[model samples]
Target: MPRELVDYRDSEEALRASEARLHEAQAVGRMGDWELDRDTGSMSWSPQLFRLFERSSALGTPDLNEALGYYSLESVELTRAAFWAAIDTGNRRELEQTVLLPSGAERYHATTIVPVKDGSGRVCKLYGTTQDITERKLAEQELRRKTYEIEDLYQNAPCGYYSLDANGLIIRINDTQLRWQGYEREEVVGRMHAAELFSPASRALFGQVFRTFKRMGVLHNMDMELLRKDGSILNVLMSSTAIFDAQGNFVASRTVLSDNTDRKQLELERTAHATRLADLSRHMVDVQENERRKFASALHDHTSPNLAALQLTLTNLARALPPAALPGLQPLLDDAQALLLDTTSGIRDICTNLRPATLDYAGLIPAVQDYAQQFRLRTGIEVHLDTADFTMQLPSNVQSLLFRIAQEALTNCAKHARARNIRIHLSNRDTRLVMRIADDGVGFDPHHLGEAGTTSPGIGLITMRERAEFAGGRFSLRSHPQSGTEIKVTFDVGRSGVLRPARRASDFANGTTLPTGTQ
Candidate 1:
């Protein structure tokens, strides 16, 4: 053979090799190439194209019928119609469809058919590409389904939810949030943001939270105030998270808010009620103290003085009688003397009941001693009083309350205990004033006694507890049937003894117990 003929043969071999390599590359990419002859009504496909259609064999020249048989019935008809339409219109067509392989596995494909024309400007051949897009199509379908599900959740969520852009502009909001604000979706969507829903005072706070969330990625359970469209304030418990893009740049904020207005209102009302109850209790105590002072003053001033003058007159009359005549009149004198003594004693007892003079003149210890003496004299209970490790003068009110508590305890013991010795102890230790009253007599269960003025109608223990509490103290009592009773009260003397301004004489005359030295 000539050298030129040999060279031509080698170039032809090289072109064939290059075509084989192109086919190999298309197969690797999961793509197939095809060509059609319009006049001859014949088609040809690369090996990859035959494989994509799941054909077991590729004959000399394939026809449209062979390709249609590879597609599902529905897809075959649609694809055929679209192919003919593109051919007649001289336009390109792209389609996606599913076809069952010979092995019975379903495959997804994308086909793009392009028309080729002869010099006469008439269609003669068609070229096309097909790609196996099963993975990509399945992924796209899954993404669409998830998007719909998320939209449903946003529309029907129970709590309000919203998203705001970096500029605080409202980007999206849930239907629940719109309803809570008394607005329709069209009214506020993309038109307002977090700041728009905040009261003036809360706007600044909202800004601070937004900035913080942007840096921190999440803000949890923040309590905030919001202004509704109706110009009412709503309390909300809010939580938010900052959204970030693929590059980790802050994009927007997603927040969930729950209404707490009702709970907040209940808490506020409870606080107000507690404050009012405290004020009323103080007022009642003030009134009670005033009444006690007035009664005490009346007993000491008017009643006692009149009884003393009467005794003086009787004494003068008794002394003026002659010594011999005095014997005959001695019985009358003795009666008058006894009557005066009884009247004076009655006056003193009445005065003590209203306000014990020893409590005002001395202190708690002396007053308790005087109380024990009076109790012993009255009930023959053989009372004893003891004090230790105490030197400071207590506030007059504390002294008065302690003395009253002692008085009530002794009275209860006298009426109910029925048996023997009573002991009263007042001492100070570790900055606390401790008072204990114990009776060795018949005792009743302490728990069985209900509150003051309840079924028991007894205020002895209740009064002591109240007084102790008023003085920042704790009160406790222990007793059992026939086991005797013991009452103990402890007060932080230094804390409760802060001196308040003294009240006046008229205040005391109006039944108020003005501070003893305040006069």
Candidate 2:
């Protein structure tokens, strides 16, 4: 073959290879090219453009009017406006269009139109490039929708939210918090400090804790009160966490505030209810005691005197009887006198047990002494009194309450304690008065104690506790099987009534036989 013929063949092969590379590049980019004849108002499309629209290339390219039918109405108007603007100004413009394909599928395309000018700089023909960007466009729409939803949630969350800079200056705040404080967003962010949002006490605590928070990176469930625009307080539970930079420097903080009003009100109501209940119990105890006092007085003042009179009359009758009928009548008169004397003595004991008069007349010390003396004589149990570092006048009610407790304790000790020796100690401290009753006997579990006024074994321990507590005192019992039982009751005398110091009797420590002194 001649040299010219070989060179011609090589050039033809190079042109085909270049065209193959161009087609591969366009296919990879999902791009196609187009041009519009300015003078003839005609259009031309590349093979890739036809494929993107799901159409065959055998048919001639569509005109502007025919192509508009493939686009949605909104896209048609946008394309029309952009086309005319570019044609008149000789400028390049880009537009996105949604096109309906012949295969009944919808697709997105981004198109760029460049105007071609003539020698006189007048716009003539147009060259353009179109890309099949359906996948990218759908992805963008999904991302935009999700972004809007997240922004909405952040702005209108249930609890208050805010962000502060390292210096405690407010930087970002959500709409919910702005509404809570009755302030506009602009008024808080960039203008207010986080400390200014809290009440004075809460602010001080926040300042102290915030330093530690920046170091620890977290703080939670701190109680605080925020001041609203109207200067009203809003109790809230605040939690915070700090954000640090890569170098471990504090950068920002995010905080959440939840209202704690309901819980606070509930606590206050519970406290008030307990106070009312305590007062009612005390009143009922007082009413019961008053009735006992009146009944005891009636027996002492009237019944005792009447019984004495009957006995005296019976004695006189015996003395005045004649010598003739003296033997027969004397026996009957003696029986009547004996019965009257017994009735009188029973009435006196009843009055003393019902409500000891010494408790009201002398004081708690004398009243307890008298009861202890009677208890020892009646039960044949050794009783000891310990009154150390105490000498003062107590309120009548207190004296009565203590005496009753002593009575009940002694009765229990005699019946159940099987005790050989019992001890009673009374003392006064700064603002409290303490009394203890202990027994050297087989002790029982304190938890199994029975009703106060019941006929059960223990001496109305329940009754003793009720009396002590109703008088604003505390009651405690300590015991274990085989050890010993000790009862301790304390009264806040300084709070209950006048508690003054009395000059101590130096010789009062000398153990005396009488119950009035230590034994």
Candidate 3:
């Protein structure tokens, strides 16, 4: 049925159709055929060949010399030798040459030459095909240039870059990383394991995480110490991403090592500076306490006794005066007694304010209690002291620190808080001596305080914090605009607070109840 349906009328028509199809295919490929006669140095070109050269039928097919004219100077000589070689050897040859077009542009042409022979076994004509491969050749050149640029960038980037195989061996590393570790590429890659590049401590951590990394596929900001070839250490932060193949199998990891030595050194210096500042603060607090104690001792021992002696003298003198003299002496005696009494009271207050006798005689708890009572009386604020579970014979300096911080905090509350009630808490809980002063008052933001210009409060908060920290304790203050304020200080007293024989809590702060058990 198929044979009957096909119609074939003329063989010549079929041949013409076939040749037309071939011409269309060649044109699409930008290829044309050529032939040259060795005998006459003449040439023949295909229909597409003429079009490729941008010549019309009027300008007949170019001869050997005419075709040679299209090539650039260098290519022409090479093409000529290739043609002569093909003719002499009776074999085929191919070469690429830059050909100049009539339109004043250049194009790369790939030309192939083959020698044809007669039945008499002699060279006759040359047959070959030429293709305009300008686009392909230009593309190849561009690709090579870009590849070189990418390789340069990878080698010279600032951060150290490296890749590791699935076995944790170094597969590739950049010049920057190699230089940092004092190693050439030949010594490290494929020879050193990733763990060998790090210090022993870092190696332990890296070993553990590297397992997890293989599974998790990502890790970030891992601080590690790198051991250089010269036995020195370099701190580095490592971050990496795992690579996977097309079938979702883990293949390798790409890692970046960032130099962190400068940051590490800065941290060390900061710690040392903080330690020095703390030492200085403690020294200053000691000197201040000593001065207060000396001043208070002078008033209590010397001045108070002198005033009492004078009062006694005045009373005895009145008793010894005569009846007529007694009238005038009585007024003088009364005025002298009143003046001395006032002066004595003034001196006692100055001594108490400078360094309270209770702080030295009764220890920190009793001193704090006495001061709290005074603070309540002076400010007309209701004060509550809760040391019901607290009793310890702490070092005198520790006692002083706690007392000063409480005093400063209470003073600030009275002056700025505008509150009605205050609660002072001293307790030993969880092996720590914790003291908290809380007030129901108009509060302010602590952050704005002690800033460049001003804040809602004064430097009292700063002083309190310094005192607490200088004594190796932690201090915290919490205050908001509408909320109340609380200052807490904790000293790590351990179970020793419970170990020592304790005094009654009421001896210090009158209102506080002594512990039922400790009492």
Candidate 4:
């Protein structure tokens, strides 16, 4: 072969190899190159450009006007302006354009335009590269949408969020917290300390605990009062997490605040309602006691006197008739006199039970002693009364309450316990007054009360408990089968509503135990 022919063949083969590599690179990158004749408006496109427009290569490259048709309506004018501007300024320009393909699908593209100038600096042709950027553009769009959603949620959440720097200055705060404190973002972000948001009292409390919280790294459900710009108070439950640096030193804190005003208001309302109910119950007890006293007084003054006079008149009539018909009428007089005496005794017993006059005159100790003696006589049960340690003089109502509780306990013992021995004890420890009544009897199960077909002693037990509670004392009962029954009532002598002291009860007692005689 001739030497010149061999060199030409080698050169042509190298050129073909370079063109093939260029085509492959364009295809892989989804990019294409094009050139436009400045004068004739003719255009030339690479093979990848044909694919990018979804057009057939057989048709060849179109003119500039025809090529612009491949772009979306909105992108057409923008692309034309860039081409013209490149020619006018003889400069390179880059733009993103939306392409409308033959298949009616839209694609995003990045185009770079360079103007070719001749020796006189007169632009002759324009060249540019277009890359299919659809996937990248879609990813960017999705990221922007998610960013917007996250920002919205952070700014408008139901609970307030704020962050403070290591120096306790408010560093970052969400919109919700700004609204809660009646502040603008600019007002609090860098100018105010976290503790400054609280009321004076709460500020002092927060100052005391905040240092501890920083070291602990977490805080939960701390109740706080926020002083708003409008001078109103907002109750809140605050929780916090501490942020630290690499060296394990505190750097910032993230805090959340939940509104607790409604719950606080509910608690206050419930307390007021309970107080009202207690007052009403105390008033009712007082009224009931007064009525019982009046009824007992009526029976003692009128009924007892009338029965005594009737017995005296019968005695006088018998004395007048005895001499004339002594033997025959003497038995009749004796029977009438016995009946009258028994009736008088029954009336006196009724009056005592209704309202023991000793309870009003001699206080609780003597009243309980007298009742216990009568209870022992009636039920054949041994009675033990111990008030050795009880030295406080209780309010009249408390004394009455304790006495009534003891009375009902004794009655239940007689009716249901079938007991043989009873002990009544009273004592005062510190500011508390305690009374206990116990019986050695066949006790029933406290839990199973009113469960079977038997008559439940629960009604009497309930009455005793109510009496104790209404007087602002605590009541408790203990009972078990084959064991015994015990009732305990405790009053807080320090509490005004529950109990109050005057002089010591020992002042009223004749001795350690009062005389157990009928009053």
List the lowest-lDDT window of 10 residues for candidate 3: 510-519
- Local accuracy of candidate 2 as per-residue lDDT tens digits, 291-342: 8889999878988777778778777877787889988887888788778877
Among these predictions, the greatest lDDT belongs to: 4
- Candidate 1: segments with Cα more than 4 A from true spot: 1-279, 391-393, 428-432, 450-459, 469-473, 492-519
Runs in model 4 lying further than 4 Å from the true structure = 1-28, 56-62, 100-106, 316-353, 469-473, 493-519
- Worst 10 contiguous positions by lDDT, candidate 2: 510-519
Candidate 4 or 1, higher TM-score: 4
Write the residue-wise lDDT of candidate 1 on 1-519 in tens digits: 999999999999999999889888888878998888877667888888877776656355468777777789888987887778778988998998888887888889898989888898777788899999988988999999999999988877777888888777888888887777877876776887778877887787877767777888998877777787898888888898998988888989888988888878987776555445534544565576568767888768887777788878878887898887888998987898798789788878887787777766787777778778887888889888877656657767667767878888888788777868988888876556778888898776555665364334145666666555544455667777788888887766555464221222222232211111101
TM-scores, in order shown? Answer: 0.52, 0.75, 0.76, 0.85
- Flag regions of model 3 displaced more than 4 Å: 1-9, 50-59, 100-104, 243-251, 265-331, 351-363, 380-384, 388-401, 416-421, 428-433, 440-484, 490-519
Assess the local accuracy of residue 299 in candidate 1 as a C-alpha lDDT between 0 and 100.
64
Sort order, TM-score high to low: 4, 3, 2, 1
Return the number of clashes found in candidate 4: 0
Give candidate 2 misplaced runs (Cα > 4 Å).
Answer: 1-31, 35-51, 54-63, 99-108, 116-127, 132-151, 203-218, 243-252, 311-354, 377-429, 432-437, 445-477, 487-519
* lDDT of model 2, residue 144: 97
Q: List the residue pairs that clash in candidate 1.
A: 290-511, 290-512, 294-511
